[model samples]
Target: MNANVTAGEAPPRAGRREWIGLVVLALPTLLLSLDISVLNLALPHLSAALGATSTEQLWIVDIYGFMIAGFLLTWGTLGDRIGRRKLLLIGAACFGAASVAAAYASSPEMLIAARALLGVSGATLMPSLLALISNMFKDPKQQGLAIGVWMSCFMGGMAIGPVVGGALLGSFWWGSVFLIGLPVMLPLLILGPVLLPEYKAPEAGRLDLLSALLSLATLLPVVYSVKTIAAEGVGAKAIVALLAGIAFGVAFVVRQRRLEHPLLDLGLFRNRALRAALGVALLASATMGGITLLVSIYLQQVAGLSPLAAGLWLVPSFVLAIIGNMAAPGLAARINPAFVIAGGLLVTTVGLLLLTQANSPGGIPVLVAGYAIAFAGTSPLGVLSTQLVVGSAPPEKAGAASALSETNGELGIAFGVAVLGSLSTAVYQSRMTDAVPSGVPGTAAEGARDSLPAAADAATSVPADLGTQLLDAARDAFAGSLHVVAVVAAVAMVLYAILAVVLLREVAPAGGAEPDAEAGPDSRAGVQEDAAARR
Candidate 1:
């Protein structure tokens, strides 16, 4: 059967092509994740090559996220109208092309432009991949295994990014890391056409060009506003940007619900399990995001560790996270995921609380231990919460549900950076004011302060006495920020724990989606068919 379709109709059954399609779909995820963290290691080379200022450097680091966050929903909807396989193949090509450009980017602006483009291309994969996975593994147990493997790979690349980057930096130029994605992407592009199934939307609806435009109008500004608040804090312009984002967002929502086939189905919020899953993803991310950033900073600034050393030392936590994530489903299958979530939160909260007591005059070991506990807490969160989210939705709405899951994570990161990250910057700047050399102007002092941890060693304009004073103050400010942020995150998690306990009362117990779990549904379907046979 030559199974293609008109604009929006039910896709032909994706028999035989299912497994291949899922693997092909996961390719873009690893490619972009690698590119993102690889740049962190490449920044020194980029700095020397581009002669970029600190603010310019911040732009380089941030613009990719801004692009990724804004376009996620846009591309997700685009796939449902067009063929998912077609877009997946197209996005892979774009990602490879972006890498080649980024590798040889002569200027900072050029590099940033390349990354933004990469973000646009990368957006195509999120919906297509989830939808493809849902179609491929309609049986819940198989789907659980598939999602676990996909998620493991996703986190694997993220966790290994720093380590891989360190190695690549030693052997290859900054651009070399970009070239690395090319080799990785080639097979996915080639195999994609042959192996992946094409998904056609079940309903025929206009692509709704106006709603698409409106989405960009609202999301881009809100995401950008959050990033701005992260870097610059809440001022008049930031306040205006935020308000503008909110107003547009409201209009966008109103427009969506009125549409025939909306870009995203907001009605999915009605599912208690789905809602709880997303809430946990967001809260957990806010806590984890804040802790991760603060720990990296603490290692470099307070403990005098190099980025490579700090990243290497942080390996234990990430490694433990892998085990924790892998073990969670099996555990959640046995015990209630809610209490498991609570236990994880309590452990993580204890870890964060341990950091407040870490303002000792001693050293870094205690801080590292605190981070390990915090990171360990995150492992279960990535798995159990996702199980609840993906497991909550019906077959057709998986992509939309998965998109919301991701949206929560992104929101977590944004809020973590805005609220907690800002607190850190403010405390660091205010407390460390006298730490700067009196000889340096206020503008320069402020500039130097804002770039802390990343450029701690290079904050060279201060006098020796002031240098020691500033360094100590910088550490204290960061610790204070860490203390405050951790408390905020911990409180949010604890509340989520209570919510999970109350809301997820009768969740599919452990292995609910496992092969064994699906037997009940299968048996029910068989009974109905047999009754029909008798009739």
Candidate 2:
């Protein structure tokens, strides 16, 4: 019973212990999501307090996500070898400790280091939580419900993170935002062993150190290269880093194919349904991440809203996203999942197109309406695509499938923030050069051109007329950048929509109708099992 291994039929309906344990799992899930967005409101405060440059600020905001994405596969596999609860408890402790360090960080470098540690620790939590949920609620309906609750908590946390952080920042220093993790984590560390069952794969293999290193090497360098290209344009350093990442990535794939017990099962990609689902998930995550950062800046700097007010403006979109998540399963059951996904993407395209028109301070309402539509539209992708990916894999490989899904999500968000943020930064800088008023001091002019926030700071040092000119130019430059990113993101959604229609067209409708005969044997069996479980 403690091992959570069931022989044939779905395990007995989850009892009281399983339900309580779910509450415990939600604790870390909430904290992890909050970490992703809490800093959006706190960024300006921290930047001012620590004198962080724009690049340093991006690193601070996104490095945690990058680290999490890099380490997820390693930790997910490791949990199978060791035990899920054990890993969760250990990670909770580490998360708590790292949060304290981040809270008291003396400089941007220190905060970034602490966040990286937080990311590594955070990686251990998700796979364990997800695998445990599947184990704890083996009945398909119960499992689905448990997952919905878990996702709701995560979505709610992300939605409310800014508001919560804004409240904290209003009353305390920026560091107070990090301390929110402490209260949630401490209780999990204490109650985890009592409430949560421990599960390890009976036939799990030894941890592959080299594959782990290769994954990290491949991911980090490529991400670095993308960020660099955006920051400094195409240069020797960017090219070398990109090439190194690609080479390492090739090696990682080759090694996975060769290994008896690979960290990742390269075979999973053969299932076209899973492949397309993950691709859609990654791009969607990236789009959402980039929008979150840009909108946060626009709310505070361009529209000149207070942090609390800005956070409030964001609440409706996230709430609607949670609604969309809740509705995706039923929608999929009613129609082919491909069309549902394509429809959602189309709605997202509409949202992005609306954002393209948001080029002035008066566009606040436009941004809000577009963001809500975009969030709600993309919500189905999160739930439905994850189901497709996991349902496309063999039961034994579910953990790996789940790991891949989670990794793509984390990495996509990081990529969005870095690449899109950099692109916007590039555009903003280019525009500011020709836009700043004459007679501004050199340092002040250079500062204004650096970023929107810097422009706000520089404006105070000059005469009102010149300062207004500088601020207006910065706002216009950023709005134009937003327009460009929106168009690009909308185009991406359209392409992915077409891809879903083509690639996922054969997938069984949600309530688990059997896949068409054209599906690979593995996918067919997986879908059959998923359907049986639901029944």
Candidate 3:
């Protein structure tokens, strides 16, 4: 019996069948995230095998994500109009076929095309999986727990993807990495129909083609610009792309407001609870993405750890985060979810402050501990934020809501990398401006100021003492930059925590009744009552 159920009330509970169905849904979720990181370690072997040029290599690695972001909104609402289960199975079939094509492609162009196809197919999986979970798990408590498990699998896959790719590459060709998706997707296609329930909105009208194209136009160039800035710094190309995306974005918003059936359902943003949850997710993902990348580089360049060792050191943090993700839902069932989420953010702020104390070469232990603590605090945010975002929506709009959640995640990561990465580079250059040894060649001195990686290369050609001084100064500068990033992220986390508390305080515990005030604007209360009566 549900804790919130009254004497005569009976909320439908998820039982054995639903649990099994969750495992089925989890398959592609895991596989998609795994694909994101798996190709990284295979880059060298594949480049050698395919003779990929520098630009082709970038496309081969990046196109998967590019396509995923571009197609997310389209597939998200498509599932609501057609059916989530139907979309999931179709996506599984497409993903498996693309995996096979990628596994055997003889040329870089063929491989890139296969990867782009995989991304499109992959975008169909996340929204479908999440929306289907909404269909199967009606009770809020059960829904929260299910979402926790789902988030853990997604994060767990990312954590282990490089390890999985490395193991495959050790004994087999580069193509073996692509083949790994086959086993995962094949089972999903076979079991999905039998285990998963089908769901679609009854009143869902035809998808607006113009809105779909506008969304693509709005997202693709913006994502492209952000990524370009992160890679090559600010340029005219990035500026033009950014401006074009903003223009199209305004058009997309106008069309959505005027259309009978918008591709995205912009009205969903009017719900305060939904908006707050998404804001938390976006801010958290952005800060985490920026810090994660900087830490990886620090481990390798400043700490002088090998790639494998850096990866190994980060496992404990991921493991702790998974643990937190699994535990938060159960806790939230008893406490106010707002409090739980806010408390977790406070904990994360502590970890970020700890990170500011780390130094070069000797700060490995502090870095690892800080990262683990910070990530553990973050686990609750991911789990509950996703739950809140989905639950705040009307049942029929869940697909679009889920897509919005995911799209924010993608944009957050790109935005964080661009902004925080640029900040780090600027700080490093400022510190290194006059630190280069005077006798060094003009080219080496200029190169040393470019980046830490460039400094290492510059050191190789300079006199031994000069090289030592330059490398030491470069390492310290990068470490100091990390300090600045940690402080900035810490401040952002604090502000987000406050906003989550204020905006989400009306949200009920997973097992309890919603506040009467929320019933006024959102209609979530009526929907909950309807769901209860139906259950």
**Winning model by lDDT:** 3
Per-residue alpha-carbon lDDT of model 3 for 40-116, expressed as tens digits? 67888899999999999999988888888988999999999999999989999999999999999999999999999
Give per-residue lDDT, candidate 2, residue 365.
90
Go through the candidates in order and give the C-alpha RMSD of each one to the true structure.
Answer: 6.4, 4.4, 2.7
Deviation of model 3 at 305, angstroms: 3.8
TM-score of 2: 0.86
The CA lDDT of each predicted structure is 0.68, 0.80, 0.85
Query: TM-score, each model?
Result: 0.85, 0.86, 0.94
What is the lDDT for 31 in model 1?
Answer: 69
User: Per-residue lDDT of 413-532 in model 1, one digit per residue for the tens?
Assistant: 887777777777777666565666566556656665775652255345556666565566666767776777767767776786787678665565543432122224422333233234
- Residue pairs of candidate 2 with colliding backbone atoms: none
Stretches of candidate 3 exceeding 4 Å from the true structure: 1-10, 513-535
Ordered from best to worst lDDT, the candidate numbers read 3, 2, 1
**Prediction 1 TM-score vs. true:** 0.85
Decreasing TM-score order of the candidates: 3, 2, 1
Quick one: best TM-score, which candidate? 3
